[model samples]
Target chain A: MKTRLTGRVWKYGDDVNTDVIFPGKYTYSIADPREMALHALEDLDPGFVAAVRPGDIIVAGKNWGCGSSREQAVVCLKEAGVGAIVARSFARIYFRNAINQALPIVTCDAVDGVENGDEITIDFAAGTVKTPRRVFTFPPLPAEVLEIIEDGGLIPHVRKQLGR
Target chain B: MGKTFAEKVLAQKAGLQQITAGQIVTVKPDRLLTHDNTSAIAATFRKIGVARVADPSMNVIVLDHVTPAANETYAISHQATRAFVAEQEIAAFYDIGEGICHQVLPEKGHAWPGAVIVGSDSHTPTAGAFGAFAAGIGRTEAAAVMATGEIWLRVPESIRVQLHGTLPARVSAKDVSLYLIGLLRADGADYCSVEFAGEAINAMSVGERMTLTNMSAEMGAKNAVVEPDEKTLAWLAGRVTQPFAPVYADADATYASVIEMDTTTLAPQVACPHTVDNVAPITEVAGKRVDQVLIGTCTNGRLEDLRAAAEILRGKHIARSVRLLILPASREILQAALAEGIITDLIAAGATLLNPGCGPCLGAHQGCLAPGEAVLSTSNRNFKGRMGSKDAAIYLGSPATAAATALTGVITDPREV
Candidate 1:
């Protein structure tokens, strides 16, 4: 995983749950990861999928991804090429899912400092998010989680462990 | 410092004398649960190059989400899951119509005190009502567990909630859960192990305790538990044939915070539109118009919930403008409700009896809301477009409140009815 990266920001408010992140309607219907990306934020932000470029960051208020344990919520964002998600906080299961999917999830109070379309730089090793105005620091991801992310998610990591 | 329930349970599972919060440990879970998503998990498991599940007996598969195949896609998924279960020689598979995974797990003897359980669904913590340490994991990790039979976990900090006094008429455990969620927003207990205690909690039935632990997921809890008592033993007597020891917190266990509530002054609670934490008392939003009233799902779809709704709607028909839907959590719940004539009463009162499964709670099918419509549901979530159209609104409450709202075609206070 890249330790330092820059991206454009897509800002949102508190409690952006799984259903809105990846609508439940297509849950059973869509099986392909690429197709799942098309419906990302279809319910809440309809313009997101079509406009989101690879490496765009999502800056949101507290408790982002607060509902459902569906991994599709994480998959869609990863497939959409969202560089990282920096929120004030995240629901527990979502945080785990993000790591398993190798998606960067940073928890810190950076929502107020950044706005939509702002250019921001994230240094995972430094544990800092540098915005146009200020720099916000978050506790670094645990070493185990970083290892999983570095190995391209848990599936590949486990595969390596099993000598497959 | 003395250990909390989570620390104690994890310490035992890890074969250690003691463990503290915030430490990481790797342990084999007693049970691994997957529902309709089993097919997806199986696919991921195959990608890991595991020919067979490390231990098939540790797996419990349930087919409740969008059951009976809402379409060809869902049917194909279920078909694949069945094939995987057969290939893996998994004996704990529950086919369609059995029930929601959370309800089916404990009922079928998979969950017991001191068991470490994990599932692919967020409400997996419902099994914690039996004094088990149950938490939800994602599909990827669930696949990993299937392949390796072990998982890594971070010991969560504990939050102690003490409930005092007795609930008044028409108020139930669902109200208590909503009150707690409102008090501690959606992220109040994020990644923390929440323990329910005190007189009001001990007074609750196992089913009611299940409701509390089930909704605890909405507050971002890693898991939630109520201490196992004789009631828990009584409920599991026949189902659980194996002997097990129940774990408890130390007398002076350290906690991040302690909260206490008096149930006597509590009123019926409702989680309003867009968020589960955006909650209010029934009186605050009473009499609001509604197009539908859904009384089922993992959260409040048990026999007691049905009885509560039936008690309010016995012999009286629902409002013409409202569409009332009743779905029991499982086939067993459906059978028991049928035996008690609760089904007949609810049907006679103009409630449409959907099959026992997670109908419309996730908005996959059965009852999708149209634009500009509103529903008063007895489910846990009320997120935007959760029931169907983005413009549609979902207000969540207990079964009694759902029935009362269906009776008047508006969100009504159960006590007033």
Candidate 2:
């Protein structure tokens, strides 16, 4: 896992739900992770999949991913190569899903300073987000949660625990 | 200081005498729930090299989403789930037509007071209405729980909401929930354990309490509960025969925040398209055109909810321009409605009765909308494109509001009707 990530920001407002992140209609139809990436944010931002680059960060307002417990919502974005997400807050299930998928999530107010296409750096080691204008610090993740992420999410972590 | 309900429960589950908010503890949940997604979770479980589930009896699998196999893909998924259930000897499997996972879980006695339950669906918190510490988990973690029979949870700070006063006629628990969601906003109670109390909550039926807890997910609650009373015990008398202790917050429990509301004059509430918190009083959006009206899903699809709609539509046909759809949350609810003659009344009133499952609420099939059309539903969500075309709209209201709207072919105030 990368301790620091630099990416262009894709910003959004509050209540960016899973329905728009990965449309529910295609849930059962799409089984391939690569195929799932094609539809990320298809409803909320039609151009997201085409324009997003690997390691791009998503900056959003409060309550990001506030609907559904579909892991595909996180899987699609992770497969799309999103490096991290910075939001004021996130729905509980989505937060857990992201960690399980090894997608970096930061809870902070850095969204206020970032804009679309602006370069930002998330330094997990320092628990800070560096925007072009300013730097915002967030509380560091727990050691156990950080270990799960470092092990490339919960699946691999659990596999290692089981000595697989 | 006294401990809150969440603290008390987590502590007990962890085999500790005390625990505080924000501390992480690993405990074995009493039950784990999965719906149609059980197929995907089963695949992940295999990847973990676990040939057998740690505890098959602890798992509850239900086939509800996109039931009857909307297409071959869904059919294959359900088939795989059945195979997994058979192989694992999972005794708590509920096939299609059993109803939604949330509704089926408790009815089958999987949920009870003080139980720690985790599910792969967001509405898993609906079981909290039974006084369980239930929360939604992701598919991957669900697989891990299956392999390890343990889960790590962060004890959440508690929010106490006290309700008082009698609800006016034409007002219901759905209205009270909508009013709270509107007041709290979408993220007001983020990651908090919400506790409902006072005389108003005590007066509500178990189904009504379930509606409140189910809608709590909309406001980002980790879990929500109403303390178990004689009413809860009465509802679970035969279903939950096991001896279990219930947990409650101490009188002086510390809370993150406390809110109080009087429901005597609450009006029917409506959440507009695009966001659950984007709410308005029914009067504000009344007379708005609606092409369809739906009354079902885990949110408001209980027997009482159907009866509420039928009462309004009894001996009255819906408007010609509108299509009214009714789905009972479970086969049990369907049978109860039929026995009560509620289904006949609704069908005679120009409503289409779908099977007892999650029909069209997720937009996978059944009644998707056309662009520029608007539907008023009793479901929990109204996100853009939630039902069909991105350009279409979804409005959320109580079952009473849905019945009145179907009768008028537009959004209508239930009280006014």
Candidate 3:
């Protein structure tokens, strides 16, 4: 599976909670992927939906996506066509949920150097991020974990391996 | 190979002789839980036209939030949840004033020791008080669990927190947890189970242990569990409908890391603006002044938390500049606080008590802060705009600090009380 990613990084400030990722009230009527995509980051950034594109990533400081454990926060990003999310850190639940849903979550320090809209590249195997200004190294994933990301999600991957 | 809590629980529930970490396995929970806040996931099931819960007998829903209908929006949310539960014939549905989902689940005996449980609320780890191996999941995950009582878990590495010494007066479990958050930082236990051990943890009461394990989520821990003891068994004897043995960590358990704390030397630690990790000594941020002081939520919105706050606020009133909102986690807590005279005393001290529910913490209901206003709150998260206005500042601390700030209308140490 491919282990490299390059994208324009969207910069978000600290404590970008699940609510800001996916609003609450809109949750009542629709679970369609597009419904959340329309409102992604509406609370935090008004034009986030329009501004983002597929393969785009978000760079944030500590406690990124930290509020209530809502899966839609990830689904919103998924529908927003976010290819990978690289942050300094992630809330444990978001990290787990994002991985489970097959969203690429890369944690790399030196996100400050990767400005918004700057096309950045991530190499999951080498555990490094490369941009115009700097090359940021990250903690690499174990081969099995990389396989989990490669096969899409836990259930699908497990099903395939077991031939079920 | 050494087994993790996840491995053990999954193996037991899957009816397997052996299981490995890194392998795919399904686990049946002894109990399952969801609340009004995450009931939206069940709503998603309605989209798929899942007419019935995957397992009606095991599922439970508690409407702790939006209780008393803060407004029309929340009322509708609760109504939708009720519709789903009634349609599915889910036996464990809890309605208005049913108590914080965590507090009620164990107090009512649904949680059993060594039982693997899942809930939509992140603090479902609170059921660890009963020695249940409980963890929180998101709505889709909850929905998946609702569909199949099995959910996948990556066995987390374990971290041992061997705490020594006793807490000083005025320093409660909240203070101890804050101290741990400060020392360990938010991601200190990322993807790891924090096993609370040592003299201090063993000496703590069941409720206090629950308080500790409950907020391990704040530190991004996978689960925080205390090795059950006589206290846990005794706490369960009267409450549990079906008796169960308490689960204890192995005597020679392996841990990825170990943390030590002397509770006596710890003062109240406060998480400063915007992040749970931005912690510092309260003395550093005291007298910073506040526009609001909030005391309550799933974190510290119980009767004991209220009593602690009332003890600090009884003879004093908040400053004119501050608005103090005290919300009980449930109507039961409210009644207990009122019976203990804490509620009336809090109201007399100029504290506005809201009906039992998660109010300002979500910013969906009451007590939003205006721009430039600062608040000392006991709620779990102090993320920007979390309480309505993005421009407002939040300082996270224990209920005592929240109460002390309510009394002085500025941040102060509860030790002064």
User: What is the C-alpha lDDT profile of model 3 across A57-109, one tens digit per residue?
Assistant: 78788767775677778888988988888888888788767876788887877
Can you give the TM-score per candidate against the true fold?
0.99, 0.99, 0.88
Q: How should the candidates be ordered by DockQ, best one leading?
A: 1, 2, 3
List, residue by residue over B131-166, the lDDT tens digit for candidate 1.
999999999999999999999999999999999999
Clashes of 3: 0
Model 2 has an lDDT value of 0.93
Clashing pairs in 3: none
* Model 1 Cα shift for residue B219 (angstroms): 0.5
- Residue B49, candidate 1: C-alpha displacement in angstroms: 0.3
Return the lDDT, model 3, position B368. 78
Cα lDDT tens digits, model 2, A90-128, are 888999999999999999988899889999999988999
**What's model 3's overall lDDT?**
0.77
Pairs with steric clashes in candidate 2: none
| Model-by-model DockQ, in order | 0.87, 0.86, 0.34
Indicate whether candidate 1 or candidate 3 has the larger TM-score.
Answer: 1
Runs with alpha carbons beyond 4 Å of true place in candidate 1: none
Candidate topping lDDT: 1
Error of 3 at B227 (Å): 2.2
